[model samples]
Target: MTEHRPVNITGLALKIPPALIFILWIAMMATLRYIFPGLNYELFLTPYVVGLFFILGIFLVLAGFFSFRKAKTTINPRKPEKTTAIVTSGIFRLSRNPMYLGFLMWVIAWAFMQANLVTFVFLPLFVFYMNRYQIIPEEKILLSQFGDIYYRYLNKVGRWL
Candidate 1:
């Protein structure tokens, strides 16, 4: 008989598409601000910070998307086994997960826009969830699928730059 792996009873592992999760985080952040209006705080140069982060967010996202397109590889995050090639071009040179990084930047931008100190809490939570549920799982699949080739690439690149 073939080997069978244990599965997550919650059916969450490697199941939810990361974009959906990102959008969920955005919604949650906005909801937190709504629930606690007084949580809003002020910072110096909020507009400039928001502008810089938002632009950087979108830029990294598009760069990562296009890099995958140029490489003609899979962009599906929920299914890492679908990946056809190791992308090491463009933004991938700087970050192994630029799209995720962009999503994080967008979260920071949203937090600034809300000016809610409570909203800022989601930053670390976002990183934690993504790292635990998404990145680590993806890394395992890529490592298994690509073997030593991907291992070397992993050594050379940071997960988020």
Candidate 2:
């Protein structure tokens, strides 16, 4: 008889929820804005740009939420294994992780509102943290759960637009 070892799909990292991460990033940006007043720059259409991105972000988030609700799947990022269905309809068609993308847009909107170029540096860090700690682990569990169907969906949709 051959002995088999089960694979550890869950990641070994700080499994902070995506919403908390978003809040932390926003707070960090706010702190930076206060700490370095010289870094601020005035933009002509800051309000319009910020409003547009904020609204778009909210829309993406709601669409993603509704899609998941409609699918009767779990939206909790910390437990991808709990996801009952692979959502591939509506906003999911455009982005594999529309909710995360929405959060990213909110960050962008905050950056614009702050009008601080230095704050933009946090954007890539946000992406890196999300990909490393959150998305990758979830992807592993999802791949194990949905197999080729998930892979096909991944190949079809962009992770973020």
TM-score of each: 0.90, 0.92
Tell me the lDDT of model 1 at 37.
89
Q: Score each candidate by Cα lDDT.
A: 0.86, 0.87
Tens-place lDDT digits, model 1, residues 1-161:
11323333234667777788888988998999989988788888999999999999999999999999988898988877788888998899999999999999998998899888898999999988888888888887787777787889999999887
Worst 10-residue stretch by lDDT in candidate 2?
Answer: 1-10
Which residue pairs of candidate 2 clash? none
lDDT of 2 at 4: 26
lDDT of 2 by residue, 1-161 (tens): 11222336545433788999999999999899989899999999999999999999999999999999999999988778788899888999899899999999999999999898889999999999888888877776777777788888888888785
**Would you give me the overall lDDT of model 2?**
0.87
Q: How displaced is residue 37 in candidate 1, in Å? A: 2.4
